[model samples]
Target chain A: MLKSRIIPCLDVNEGRVVKGVKFQNLRDAGDPVELSFHYQDQGADELVLLDVTATRQERIAMLETIERVRQRLSIPLTVGGGIGSIEDAGRLLNAGADKVSINSAAVRNPDLIAAMSARFGAQCTVVAIDAKKQGEIFQVLTRSGTTAEAIDAVAWAARAESLGAGEILLTSFDRDGTRSGYDLPMLSAVTDACSLPVIASGGADSVAHMVEAFQHGAHAVLAASIFHDANMTVGEVKQQLTDAGIQVRNEW
Target chain B: MIQIINTGVANIRSLQAAFDRLGCTWNLTVSPEDIATASHVVLPGVGAFAAAAEAIDQLGLRTAIIDRINHRESATLCICLGMQLLCESSEESQSAKGLGIIPMAITRFGDGVKIPQLGWNEVRPLDNGPYDAGEAYFANSYRLETAPDGWGAAETDYGGTFISSIWRGRTLACQFHPELSGTWGESVLTQWIEGITC
Candidate 1:
């Protein structure tokens, strides 16, 4: 049986783990390696080290962090943030990242998804979609959800899959840090839109939210706040999911 | 010491980390001598079939690996694409030749299921196989549908039943990643290191 993956995302800036309440005012959490150990100890299937502020030097810091953290990691690790080109993806992969996720760059030039997928194999090319629910539709946002785009979230996901993205990281900007729960309708919409596996992200406060995301058709649920705040371990979440009759990997 | 055959396509850092955590001594090698002479060899791979097959040949590891396997003195563990490389051939790359250890065809997952099936899938051992496999992480588009002759296998269900791991004598090849699968996965590496020959 294929299980729904539980991923804990670490918002990284300048190589340090930072958790921002709604993408504003970054606060240090801990070293990425330490936090990674924390999550994996609770049986996290994978880790996403998303570089929040992806400047030139910060990108290098991200690489360094990946290098150090990877030595300690046993599971898969995904590196994202300001990955503007194939070279950037290449650098991260070379630095020992198992996969690379593209956001703003993929939106600006959708072809990059095809190129990276072709170059690195579709297995490692992830397209992250930051979206906010607008009236009657979900609108895609960019640059850490500051700029709203005319692109439809569901439509972009379908296009991204067609353009060769292997997976979609659909984050809800409207619900992020709100503890409101995953945007279920938005999640199901994107899942229905694309054939690729969709990872539900943002605004999860409890195990029920994760269960809701899975029931809504997420192949995986990526939550940050709940894990970071010590509200639940990845083990606890999976235990609850299993109790709720959702198939989650328990042998790990 | 375990010699990990690095054919340039593999992200071996995590694999290496797994070994280190196990307190196992290992080395990354493209050297044929190392492949031929190591007590055990781990062929770790990531990426396309043709590219990986080409890299093995380019690094002059072809005959070396085959000879080592034939000798049956030690063992070789193939991981993911490494396992695919052991097959007769694949639908993915028509022109490329496999090492032909498994003597089976590798085909893509059906249209109904997602391609490049990522994340974890349950793995069960069959016919007195060495490892239990136990919910391993997988990331591949192509898979072996059935077990070949003279080998015990661990199977997984997706679009249908597919062989996830195969064991013969002391040798093992897994389609799923034991390195990235945490506890049970690390135990797979440990048993391989402990040399629990079937």
Candidate 2:
């Protein structure tokens, strides 16, 4: 019985939590530790802390923020942004992160996944693929969804798993912030191609959307706008899923 | 200094980090000689039990470390898959043998609780006197069902009241990741460090 996880993602910049409407016009949400504890209390399965700022300035700040958040909760924390090397993943793991999500760096250096997974375990590594559907195929995007890459999402996900990525956090750039629902076709394509767990991200407006993502083969569903805007708390979303007969962790 | 036996498993870095955070000095040893001279041994692992157990045998430190645990009152802390190794065998890998220090076997959670029981779980001390209950971190698919003679600790719910933590003679174990368990984990580690006399 693998429960579908409900994650609340927080975009961190310069030690502060920021929430953007659609990856633009960011507004300060709160402190990293405070927001993390709040999300955990509200029944978030895990917290994703994305260092939204440019990599150069926020490296140390991001690490410190992760450490502070780690001190506050015992839940799994996934740190992304500027993690370009095994040393970066090691440093983050040392600072108390459960998993590290690699985006542009992973796509650029596919061997990093294998090397890190060899040093650390595959379960400790996750590849976050930002994808946007074009024509019939969804393509992987880099630079936090700003750059449209020509790589096929499904193929890249399979490659990632082969390279020792334990899980795939697939985000739908087209559906991001639109809240219409997740790009189920894209998620299903990736999950079918790879045996690893797939966490569906983006375009989850209602509780039903989250359920649909799981039903469509997502191991877990992630929604940032819904959770951040207070439209639907993680608890409420889990409750809705449970009522809909979808398996979700009952702890919260 | 305590020696953390690395049997080709995960969580060693985090364990080392925890020790560092506690200002405790320790060494990560995969050698038989280092384990033999070590005052304390911490076994930290994750993933499949069979693979890890095979790794322990392959590394050839199994007998040496176990000898250290049995011969002296050395502090031995096994976390997650390492804790599972204390049992006799696991259903996850029935062919894979365990260290058999506690006369227990690993069983699946079944249709009851979820597999890979991910995230945080509370430790409800088996009420066998001396132990206290606290929240602990866990991430595993199989559980250790100890025989009555060796059941050290148990968590409250999930899968027919299994042993979440066990204490048999000098050997101590917890299915949870103490390094990831926060303050309660630190307390558990402290107790292990202080109570176990090497």
Candidate 3:
């Protein structure tokens, strides 16, 4: 069976891996490459390197950091933050990123999804939608989940899939860092709206949450704090998922 | 001397970077002019059938690729979607026509499996296959249902049945992403490149 994936997200700023409590007051985690290699060794299925620094100087630094990480890790690495054009996607992919994720840029230029899909192949292109619960709908939020937009997460996910995005990385701002478990309702909405694989991010507290994410329609689960704080290991998470009747990769 | 025919699929950059890491000279090309002079060819893609087939047709790379693969018996390695394109057709999209070099048909994994078979998978080699069974990366919705035409070198199990890999001949392919499949995947590329150069 197609095994469910467990991915570790590394937040990078100025080429250094940084961890923040509740996405604020960032603290240096370590070198991006070393941290990524550590996760890979710890049995992470994939690594998502989000270059949180959006400045031009930071982008150059981000690219250099990406190059370094690419040389070190052998598994899939996805980089987001400040990705705007197909050319940018091309450059990142050339630099060794297995996938290029677009959150804010994808919202601004929806057509960029199709263009990147055509140029880089859909599987290598991911549309990450950060959302905050707004009554009955999960409103898409940009700028690292600070600004909420009127866009419906489900609707945008459908549009993204139609535009040829291989996968949709859905993060819930409401539950992010709360460790209350993933927002099953919102994830169900996105999964019900699109046929593409969905990666559930935010609000993963324990191994149970990881297992529940897959049960609630997530093809893969993305977690940070829990993994970063050494609460649980990727191997343990996979083991838990396996115990819960979810197909997971055993040999890391 | 090798040209990775860009038929507008994803994962080209990874292949290019892998080739770079291996110190193997290659170019990403879809033009006939480039294909004509290439000693070896690589067809790399990552997407559904409709888009991939459409890209090949739109770029008019079908003929150039066919001419080179058929005439020179040029060594070709098709990764992931590129491997699917080597088949006769895929169920992902009805309109998607494959290169038909390998006599297989693409089909979707049943309800037991997820849509996109993402993550690392193990490859089991048959006796006298191209490479021994090892871990290979995969991310795809549909897979080639039947075996390859002349060579059925390797296979992998997703949920039920086994999928083809290292389906060697002048035309070779694997549904897994060798470029991202780690050291073993790179070794497969080295073997393929060496086979072609030989």
DockQ of each: 0.71, 0.19, 0.41
DockQ-superior candidate, 1 or 2:
1
lDDT (10s digit) by residue, model 2, range A120-154: 66767889999988988998899888888889999
| RMSD per model, one decimal | 2.9, 5.9, 4.5
Per-residue alpha-carbon lDDT of candidate 3 for residues B53-95, written as tens digits (9 for 90 to 100): 8888898878776676666366777788787787778887776
Residues A202-239 of candidate 1 have per-residue lDDT tens digits of: 89999999889989989999999888877777888888
Task: Kindly give the stretch of ten consecutive residues in candidate 1 chain B with the minimal lDDT sum.
Answer: B66-75
Q: After superposing candidate 2 on the true structure, give the runs of residues whose Cα lies further than 4 Å from its correct spot.
A: A20-29, B1-42, B46-76, B84-198
lDDT of 2 at A117: 71
The Cα RMSD across the true interface for model 2 is 5.0
Candidate 3 runs further than 4 Å off: A20-29, B1-11, B19-41, B47-75, B87-100, B103-117, B121-128, B153-162, B190-198
Off by over 4 Å in 1: A20-29
Residue-by-residue lDDT tens digits, candidate 2, B58-143: 99977886787666466678888888887788897789888886576788776744344655556777645224676665666678
Better of 1 and 3 by TM-score: 1
Instruction: Give the per-residue lDDT of model 1 (tens digit) for B1-198.
Output: 989998887767778878888888998899999988889899988888988899999998899998887675587888999989888899999989999876778999988787779999999897787776487889999999999888888899988899899887778899998899888888898888788888
Residue A142's lDDT within candidate 1 is 94
Best by TM-score: 1
- From the highest lDDT down, the ranking of the candidates is 1, 3, 2
